[model samples]
Target: MPRRGNRLLVVGLVGAAALTSAMAVAALATGAEPVAAGVVCPNPVDELPAIPAGARIQVERELSALDQQVAEANERLVSTAGQGGPNFAQNAILGPLRDKRAATLERIAIAIGREADRPEGLEQFATCALLGEGEQPAPTTTTTARETTSTTAAPEQEQDDVAARIACPDPTGALPAVPQAARAEVERELANLDRQVEEANERLVSTRGQGGPNFVDNAILGPLESKRAAALDRIEIAIGRVSDQRPGGLESFAECSLG
Candidate 1:
């Protein structure tokens, strides 16, 4: 083992290194120009909360929704881009919102990836188990006999609803071609929406029935509220992407909003 003084030196070095790396990452992500290496950020100690091993399933759930959102929207995005549009004003509104939505989903995926780097996060993937209230890991259910059942039957209803929602566009009518700028905006908006939904769902599941500290930190309560606030911020950003002179008839930027 290292001597006391050596251990203190090592601990300080590790903390400094972690803070420096985090600063670089945040700067790059935000597109901020780097300051001198000696310049410290205001909150050097800030760190993402450590995801528990028990939280792996929650992380996975967020990831799955995020991936599905992006996958489902990809074709629709291309279709929107290829079709003729009423122009950037009407078209601009929808495309960007869609793009932001996708980005939101992507963010959830990214967060999950980060969470997975933790010790508990990695172990959870090895089996079908749950972390009990006391941090003890065990098989998911109480009864041993019930554990044999598989749970993959829920997709039929989902698929049916999707098929119903997207009726084929008019055979005779030519859709407007989506401008390149509009399509780019659409993609960005979709990503944003994905993040918003992911955070929301994560909160809902986490906060279900807990109280006190859990209530304060879990998504079911506080996290959902935070996600809601984030969604509003994203919405404002999406709206600002549109021209101010947009015609008066629109109720929303979504496709379903077009009269």
Candidate 2:
């Protein structure tokens, strides 16, 4: 009988060990945090703090304000295409909007007793959605490009005017906006001429030992100088007549066409 009892005890011990290992594997597979033996895992929702009164409303309000800010910045960008480039607009406008949105998310997380260390772009407000149940949803309409011509062209023309107005310095201290198409053409020409000038300079440097002084002067420098002058003339014309005043302290764009 003693021998029989010893065998039963050994069997029970092994079974218990196998059960513990299985539990651990299951916990890991389901991403549940491991708990000490005999301890119960706490429910995640139970860990959240009780919702405070008006918390949801306040969060919604802040979100609305942030949305307005983003919208305004977008409008400004559309109105002014040459507003110091895309980086400038992002830094000056979008960055702040995103930060505010993140802060609102953090605030909501804290109110609901959740960890605020969530990854960006995945912010959630569980209770906030309830606050909008009585409100009507905003209507949305989709319009194809062909149908949007009348509406889109005006904004584009306005953007072009803004670009031209700021592209060149005003001679009489009065800036004027121009057509967007014209601005694009002018900028393109300026860029092309700028490349040509660079190529000419490179050619002049390469011709140093290949020819005599007169040959270098006539074949390379003379033609290059002429092209540079022509580019400058085109740039000036694109800049419009206002630049003829030289303005208060506007630097000469003519230098860009020079070697």
Question: Judged by lDDT against the true structure, how good is candidate 2?
Answer: 0.36
lDDT of 2 at 100: 56
What's the CA RMSD of model 2 in angstroms? 33.2
RMSD of each: 24.8, 33.2
How many collisions per candidate? 40, 0
Give, for candidate 1, the lowest lDDT window spanning 10 residues: 5-14
- Computed on alpha carbons, the lDDT of every model, listed in order, comes to 0.32, 0.36
After superposing candidate 2 on the true structure, give the runs of residues whose Cα lies further than 4 Å from its correct spot: 1-181, 241-259
Tell me the tens digit of each residue's lDDT in model 2 across 132-223.
11232221111122224324457765464233211122222322353454466556665765576566566545432222223333333334
Enumerate residue pairs that collide in model 2: none
Residue-level error in angstroms, candidate 2, position 4: 99
lDDT of 1 at 130: 13
